[model samples]
Target: MIGVLTSSMAIVSAGGLLFALGEPFIYQVTVMPFIALAIGVDDVYVMLGAWQDTRRTLAPEKRMALALEEAG
Candidate 1:
């Protein structure tokens, strides 16, 4: 969530800077931040679900590796 918000803010700030510098803004540039937010949220949910499915018997590092592998 923090990553998502930070990235989105960066994108928007860059876009605003470009616009201020006389660059022509397109609709997609305005919309892309929201798209990124959605994708970020989806990725988090997938990672969490994968983590939950990992075997409890495994060591913590192995469990994390499996979760990331499955999610990725």
Candidate 2:
């Protein structure tokens, strides 16, 4: 999804910038961004699934709250 990609890109860009700014390009730094992105993507999928599982009869705001509660 666009949201996931946008967030992932932002995270990667920030990490890359920090690495370029004299931070050591250690293995953890090199791989952690991707690991974080994967976790983020998984979280999005879980949140979306929770949202979809919410009752259709509920109001949008209530549904969102329920989804968030479930996701959290």
Cα deviation in Å at residue 18, candidate 2? 2.7
Query: What is the model-wide C-alpha lDDT for candidate 2?
Result: 0.84
Deviation in Å, model 1, residue 3 alpha carbon: 5.3
Per-residue lDDT of candidate 2, residues 1-72 (tens digit): 865686678887887788789776666566766777778888889989999999999999999999999999
Clashes of each: 0, 0
For each candidate, C-alpha RMSD in Å?
2.9, 2.2
**TM-score of model number 1:** 0.69
Cα lDDT listed for each candidate: 0.85, 0.84
TM-score of model 2 (CA atoms):
0.74
Colliding pairs, model 1: none
**What is candidate 1's lDDT per residue for 1-72, written digit by digit as tens?**
765876778777888799799998687666778777888778888988999999999999999999999998
Q: Compute each candidate's TM-score over C-alphas.
A: 0.69, 0.74
